[model samples]
Target chain A: DVKVTQSLRYLVKRTGEKVFLECVQDMDHENMFWYRQDPGLGLRLIYFSYDVKMKEKGDIPEGYSVSREKKERFSLILESASTNQTSMYLCASRSGGSYGYTFGSGTRLTVV
Target chain B: SQQGEEDPQALSIQEGENATMNCSYKTSINNLQWYRQNSGRGLVHLILIRSNEREKHSGRLRVTLDTSKKSSSLLITASRAADTASYFCATWANSGYALNFGKGTSLLVTP
Candidate 1:
């Protein structure tokens, strides 16, 4: 089965610390995305990469960055973690067509 | 920003009953999809209805799309206790493949 693996399931970070969330997919999909899910906000895209070394900002990219050095790995970085950034982070991967995204289990991050 | 709004923020139904949820979007869309997410896990894709299709069914799930009205509905018949989860509706944009999701409808199936 196709799988998207998130390195961490739960995390606690200090304010202003640099946080990294890693994601890897085995399907060799061209598109990988990072989204933060809040209670009422649903899922908002943080960043996405279509190919290696190519990245694009989404609706809520402030204070966040992404890296895609390899075809199957995509990473999300929090430049300076803040308390407001505490939420459930989800990683998803999809191909070029109209198929639905295969999402990872998600990482619940708490910034204190 | 979210492009779709799901009606009935919460619903509770007994087992063997049918549960229906509605979603309305603002603009034209290439397709609409339904996803189910457990309490704290990732979302599982349920079904997708294209712009050209009016209705489609998979197992006990039925999805209907009305492009002219910019609306869609998901119906799950003979619901079970394991069907308790949050259901979200996402729309594929006319120009891009990125999906814009709605807030979601929380459903509970009691024994």
Candidate 2:
């Protein structure tokens, strides 16, 4: 089956430390996204890349950045981790508007 | 910001019972989708209903959309213990390509 793979399942980072969450998809989809899920906020988009080297900021893009060096790999970076940024990070990939997204297992990050 | 809001944050039902969830969105949308996530796992797509279409079904799942009211409902017939999971509703608005998801409804199906 096709899949989206996240590099880490759980992470702990100190405040002010830079954190990286990696995602890779085997479906060769054109669109990849990173979203952070909090208890009451649902899933808020951080950043998304529709093509290699192209990125767009989403609703909650503050303190976050993204890289799409290749078609299959998309990465989310936390420039300076803060305690408020602690949440479950999810990565999703979609080919087009006709289909639903396939998401990675998610990375739960705790910033202390 | 989330576009959709799902009612009844949690639900508990016995096996073989029907479970229904409702979602309401703010703006014009191209489509509304339902997703299921097992504990600590990724979401799996359950169904999608477009703005123009009122109803759609896949196996035991039935979804209905009412664009006039900007709402949608998902009905899962015959719940099983394995059906215990969190269900989220996501909407793709006409102005954007990304989907805005709701906080989700946690359902517990007890055998």
Task: Enumerate the candidates' DockQ scores in order.
Answer: 0.74, 0.87
Mind giving the per-residue lDDT tens digits that candidate 2 earns over B9-106?
Answer: 99999999999999999988878899999998889999888888999999989999998888999999999999999999998744266788999999
Question: What DockQ does candidate 2 score?
Answer: 0.87
Q: What is the overall TM-score of model 1 with all chains considered together?
A: 0.97
What is candidate 2's TM-score against the reference?
Answer: 0.96
TM-score of chain A of each: 0.97, 0.97
Worst 10 residues of 2 chain A by lDDT: A93-102
Candidate 1 stretches greater than 4 Å from native = B93-95
Q: How does candidate 2 score on lDDT?
A: 0.91
Docking class of 2: high
Cα error of candidate 2 at position B33, Å: 0.6
- In order, what lDDT does every prediction score? 0.91, 0.91
lDDT of 1 by residue, B5-50 (tens): 8988899999999999999999987778999999989889999888
Q: Which stretches of candidate 2 lie over 4 Å from their true place?
A: none
Model 2 has a clash total of 0
